[model samples]
Target chain A: MNKQLLWLPFAAFIILGLILYSGIGKDPTKLDSRLIGKAIPAFSKSLLLSDQTITEKDIKGPALINVFASWCPACYSEHPYLMELSAKEKVVIYGLNYKDDKQDALKFIDRLGNPYNMIIFDNNGRLGIDLGVYGAPETFVVDKSNTIVYRHVGEVNERVWTNIILPKMLGTEGQ
Target chain B: MKKLLVTFFILLVILPQTAFSVISVYQFDDPAKEARFNQLVNELRCPKCQNNNLADSNSELSIDLKDIIYEKVQAGESDEQILVYLKDRYGDFISYNPPVKPSTWLLWYGPFVFLLIGGFFLYRFQSSHRQDTQDQQNDEQQANSMLEQWAKEAKDQETK
Candidate 1:
């Protein structure tokens, strides 16, 4: 029993080492959203460059709420994929013009080719806070009931569309 | 002239401490509210920066969060309400103080369990060490009594 007990410390060290080692290559920046499986927060903001008031009711489901800003470089990187998703894939994408001015946002859309069905202007980023947005190029997949199923931070690429987003989009469509 | 320049540089460093050129400065008429605001910002972590709290983080998200906190405090919302609001948006990761839950039970109790194990080992070692010393002392006592008995017998023999 004493001999067996002597191995306990070594066993503990090994267990701890294994646990820490598993976390080595894992990205700490990727955080799961607390808002997942919950309905999108209600807000009455204006559409981008328009006087029309937009709300949670206005947002169509089986769609994406993409938070983007003109100043964010990652948004520029993910622009082509969003265009393809919108034009070819026929996926409904709503733009959230986060903390960007009307003129710059218009120019940005013009340059990138507008991929959004309709853009919601979040001048003060109040709506972005309501949606729990921390950075630009974040996308949330909304189900038919307007429940947010998944949220992806950073840029959305072809791999993300194929693996992460499409399944959620199709899953939400029948619901 | 060198002494004057040194004093000027010293004044330059000291003067900025009195006047902050920060963006998140909110004008609060109530000192209590201001204190609560300051406390909340320090306690709340910046979701973008990950490491820095809302008070110190210069990230855009941190600035926006600070603005929301200021509004919430100004609107006479309680600290708990403000915490709930932020927690709803950012999850428990926003607060430094994690809630007591099953998921975190290991985090809270693991150290105490290890401490108990260490304490048990130390106590066992102490008791065993005492036993060793006790046996040695008993042996010494037995030898001393034997020597005393021999000395008494020798004296008795001489006397007789």
Candidate 2:
């Protein structure tokens, strides 16, 4: 019985080693969104296209909010996929231009075809703080109620759309 | 000697330029508010730069957040209210001090549990070790007494 007890520490050490091993390749930056199942944060800001002020009330959902910056390299990397989703798949995408120069952002859109249905310029990042946005190249899927259902950080490619964003946005149609 | 002088000159010029850090210049009317602003930023973690606090990170988001926090501190908002507001948006992960929840229960209590388990094993080992020593000593005493009894019997038989 006492000899068996000697193996207990070794068993515990092995269990701990196995538990820590599972964390090896996981991305630390992928944080779970607290905004999920909640209505979009209230904001009143100006639209990029028009002089009129826009607010949370102006947003209709079952759409995608793609946060991007002209300076972020990943935003450019995901632009082609975003364009495909918008132009071909007919996904309604709202652009949240995060803390970027307006002129450079406009030039980027002009250069690579605007994939956004409407652009909300957040130069001061007031809305971004309210939304808990970490950085650019993050996407949020809002349902018809304007409730954020899913959020994907990094880039939105074909796999991400098919697996997470699409099913989250339209339920059965994604499958 | 000329090459050494040129290298020294380059280091003097470039090192100083590289050492120049961009710091937040938001001026506060009250010294208390300024202190609070400093404390708040230092406590809040920068989301974009995962390892850095808002005070240390130069990321644009961190700068904007520091500005927002400065404004709030200046507006006479308490530290608790500001933290709550941030927690609501950024989740508990934003704070260096995570709250006690089901998920975080292990993190908060794991060390204590590990210590307890170690103490338990130590206690068990020590007691079992003591028992083994006592048992061996008792066996030796019994063997010694038996040998003495046998010697007495032999002497008694010779005397008879």
Candidate 3:
């Protein structure tokens, strides 16, 4: 019995080691959204490329609301993928221009080609705060009913679209 | 040499203290509101920085969060309301003091449970050790008495 008891600490150490090992190489910055399955928060903000205003109602249908900024380098990196998605018409994509200078944002859109159907200008990141956005480029998938189904913190790439997002949208559609 | 040492100490400590005191300044209508803002920021975690709280982090996200906290404070929102608003967006991890819930039970109780289990094991081991020593002493005493008895018996036999 004493010999068996001696193994308890070893067992505990192994269990803790396994737990800590599982967390290794995982992105610590990616936080799960508390707003998943909830409706988008109410807000009306001006369009970045147009004179029109974009609101929560505009977020309806199977769509992607990507938070981006002219100042964020990651947004530039993900711009081409967004353009490809836009060209394919797989889903409607809206943009939330987070805390970017208007002239810089306009120049960025002109230089990189606009992928957003309607871009919402969040000058002070008020709406970004409402959406729980910490940094760009964060992406959200809203279902037809305007409910946010998935939120990705980093840049949306092909891997994320095919593996994480497409299946989620398909599963939602099947339901 | 002493004067030089004092000057070096002042340069290393006092001068750096003023230089590194880059705490962001914000205008508050009332001192109480400023105090509340300070407390709230310190209690909230910076989502971007991960390691630092809002007050200690100089990240852009932390600055934005601090600004939001200030706005809410200025608007006369209660601390609880501000926390709720942030938690709604950032999840429960944003708050340093997470709420007591089923998911957070392990976080709140794991250390105490570990300590309790450790203490129990320590107590059991010590008691068993003490019992083993007592048994060894008893055995020694019995052997010594047995040897003495044998010696007494031998002496009696020789006397007879």
Candidate 4:
């Protein structure tokens, strides 16, 4: 009986170890609502469209702040979605050219046909890092208060628009 | 051979501390001192394995801190005293097992408490299994004794 009691903890420990091991490689869901309900980070860059300096104040009213780069394949995937959003014109959209060569970003804008009111080039990516952006094609929906209400981390699609954006614009989903 | 075995065990305990940058529990000879070392390690976070318990981590910082803990224990400081010193320097984030303050009680006790409850169920299951086997053995023994009595009666009847 004493021996069984002694072994119990060890056996229990092994069972716990198996449970923990099964959980390896599974990423815990993260709530990245840090920038949410906070003022948008200040941004200013040379425009990829008109080759003129553009500042965040230029599109201050109500806008979608889309982070994209020429080198990112996901940006290309999101191109059509951006064009569709532009066609709606219900909400103005601005693109922040994150960590790209100026010439390539300009060329990308030309090929995609600019859907943005104006594009801001963040070549060194300082502003992008400040916005907590890790990769390209991230979009944030900002209110008139300058507080970011929504953040999408991956490629934008019709599903994202119909589900997340339209409901947000209609004020049925989030602030 | 016994002498060699003793030496081998000693080396096995001491070699890892000398070889890699892992904090170990062998530095303190006194139980009180060893407890202090454990307390210090538990508080310090392993920077490389961000989410792991420092007591379980073999990271470089953990090793260095373990050495320091060993030294402090030898110097006769209590576990609480050493922890106070570390907290002064590194703040609360240094400890993987943060204290159950208003801010961190949920974080500290949540997972471990769940694990303990799970362990309790496992213990009950193992004990119940052992009890069932013992009961089966008892039943078999009683059946064998009844069969022996029947055999004896038959023999007696034949003799009569």
**What is the DockQ for all candidates, taken in turn?**
0.54, 0.54, 0.68, 0.03
Per-residue alpha-carbon lDDT of model 1 for A51-79, expressed as tens digits?
99988998879899999999999999999
CAPRI level of candidate 3: medium
Find the 10 residues in a row with the least total lDDT in model 2 chain A. A166-175
Q: Give the candidate order by descending TM-score.
A: 3, 1, 2, 4
**How many backbone clashes are present in model 2?**
0
The ten-residue window of minimal lDDT in model 1 chain B covers B16-25
Q: Each candidate's lDDT (Cα)?
A: 0.90, 0.87, 0.89, 0.73
Q: State in Å the error of residue A39, model 1.
A: 1.7
Cα deviation of B117 in candidate 1 (Å)?
Answer: 1.7
In model 3, what is chain B's TM-score?
0.82
After superposition of all CA atoms, the RMSD between model 4 and the true structure is 12.4
Q: Count the backbone clashes (under 3 Å) in each candidate.
A: 0, 0, 0, 1
Q: On residues B1-160, what C-alpha lDDT tens digit does candidate 4 reach at each position?
A: 9999999999999898786445353655687767766666666765335466567767544555556667778988777776775554344655655677886865778699879878987898799899999999999999999999999999999999
Off by over 4 Å in 2: A21-25, A172-175, B1-26, B139-160
> Which DockQ value does candidate 1 get?
0.54
Error of 3 at B95 (Å): 0.7
Lowest-sum lDDT 10-residue window in model 4 chain B: B19-28
- lDDT tens digits, residue span A1-175, model 2: 3677778779989998998999999999888888988999999988776777888988888889999989999999899999999989998999999888889888889898899988999988889888889878889988888888888998999998898787787772343
Q: Write the residue-wise lDDT of candidate 4 on A40-159 in tens digits.
A: 766677777666876656767357889998888999989977997888755588889887888898899889888887788777665665565645678888777666777787887888
